[model samples]
Target: MRPLIAIPARFSARTSALRYAAEVNARSLIEAVWRAGGEPVGIHPADTGTAARLARFDGVLLPGGGDLAPPATAPPTPTTPSTTSTPSRTPSTSTSPGTPWSRACPCSRSAAASRP
Candidate 1:
C-alpha cells in the first residue's frame, strides 16, 4: 500500500475559477506525490481534532503561504549613535536529522550584527 501524505490546503480570498473565497492546493504538488507512489490527501485548516485526524496519515507536507504578524512587545529602537563596535565573527555550522545544514552566529554578539 502507498503511504498517505497529508497536505494542508492553502487558503485564498479569491481565485480565478472560484469567484468567492476558497481553500485550495497546488495541482503540481498533488500530481508529484502521486507519481512518487504516495496518496495525497487534502486536510482542512481547522484547529479542532487536527491531531487525531492526522494520525491516520503516514506523512505530512506543509506548503508555505500564510499571514505573518509582528510581536506585541516591539523591540526598542536605538536613538543614540554607538561609539563602540564589536569585531565580526564567523558563523558556526551544525546539522540535524532530516534537515539541511544551518549556520548561526555565537550568542555573544548583538542580534542586529548576527543577521546576514
Candidate 2:
C-alpha cells in the first residue's frame, strides 16, 4: 500500500492571543513527505471528518505545539497554612521535555535508495 500521511494545520487570525503558536507548516511538511516517497495529506484541526479520514492512514503524528496545562503529577503542598500570615507558598511551572515533533509521514524509502 502506498503510504499516506496526514499533517495537522491550525491557522489563526493574526490578532489572536497566542503567545507562541505552532510553526509546523502543512505545505512544507507535505512536500518533504512527497520527496521522501510517501503520499502526504494536509489536514486542519477544524476538519470535522479528520478522525474518519486518518483511520485510513498508516500512523498518526502529534506535531510540535505550545505547552498545555501540566500533567496531573505535581507535588502537593508540604506545610499547613497559618491564619495570621498570608499563606506563604510558591507555585511551579511545568515545561515540556523538548521532544522533537515527529513529522508524520510514511516509511517508504527503500534500502537501495542512494544516500544523500
Candidate 3:
C-alpha cells in the first residue's frame, strides 16, 4: 500500500471549478504526490479531532499559504550583515527522535538565522 500523506487543504475565497468559494488543495501538489507513489489525502483545517485523524496518516504536508500568527517573543536581528550572496538551496528534512513524522521547508535561506 502507498503511504498516506495528509495534506491540509487551504481555504480559498474563489475558485474556477466550484460555483462558490471553497476550501481546496492544489491539483499539481496532489498529482505530484501521487506520481511519487504516495496517496494524498485532503484534510480539513479544523482543530476538532485533528490528532485522531492525523494519527492514521504516515506523513503530513503543510503546504504554504495563509498568514502565520506572530511569535510570542520578539524576533532577533542579525548580528552581522551578509556580504556575499549564495545560490538558494532546498531545505533539508530531518526527523526528531521519538516524535511524529514531520518535514520542514524553509521559506527563505536565512530562516535559520532568524530563529531566536
Candidate 4:
C-alpha cells in the first residue's frame, strides 16, 4: 500500500508558549514528503480528533520546534560531583523507532544539546 503520512503544525491558536525553532516548519516537511513519493496531510490544533486520524495514516511525523512547557517539577539533585561529570557530546543514535531516521522526541532535550 502507498505510504500515508501526517505532519502536525508546531504552533497554532491554541499554542500558549513562544516558539523556539529557527529552521523549517511542518509545512516544509510535508512538501518534502510529497517530493519523496508519499501522501502528506496537515493537522489542526483544536482538532483533538487527529489522534484518530493519525491512527489511520501509515505514519505520523512530529516536526521540530520549541520546548513544550511541560509541567515543572523539582530539579534533579546534584550529589558527589568532583571533576568527572561531563555531558555526552555524541548525538543520539536514533530518535524514532519505526521511521527511517529515528527521530528523537522534540521535548526530550533542549535545543542547544541537539543542534548540529
TM-score of each: 0.52, 0.41, 0.59, 0.41
Best by TM-score: 3
Model 3 RMSD, rounded to 1 decimal: 9.8
- Residue 79 lDDT (model 3): 43
Candidate with top lDDT is 3
* Model 3, residue pairs in steric clash: none
Q: Is candidate 1 or candidate 3 better by lDDT?
A: 3
Ranking by lDDT: 3, 1, 4, 2
Once fitted onto the true fold, the runs of candidate 3 whose alpha carbons sit more than 4 angstroms away are 69-99, 103-116
Which regions in candidate 4 have their CA more than 4 angstroms from the true location?
Answer: 10-26, 47-50, 68-116
Order of candidates by TM-score, top first?
3, 1, 2, 4
Once fitted onto the true fold, the runs of candidate 2 whose alpha carbons sit more than 4 angstroms away are: 14-24, 47-51, 68-105, 108-116
- Model 4, 2-116: lDDT tens per residue? 4666666544434326454332245556666665555766665445555455656655555544563222211223642323222222334452344332433232233333335
Worst 10 residues of 3 by lDDT: 80-89
On residues 1-116, what C-alpha lDDT tens digit does candidate 1 reach at each position? 87777778877799888879988889866766676666878988887777677767765555544452212112223743332221113335332333211223222133234345
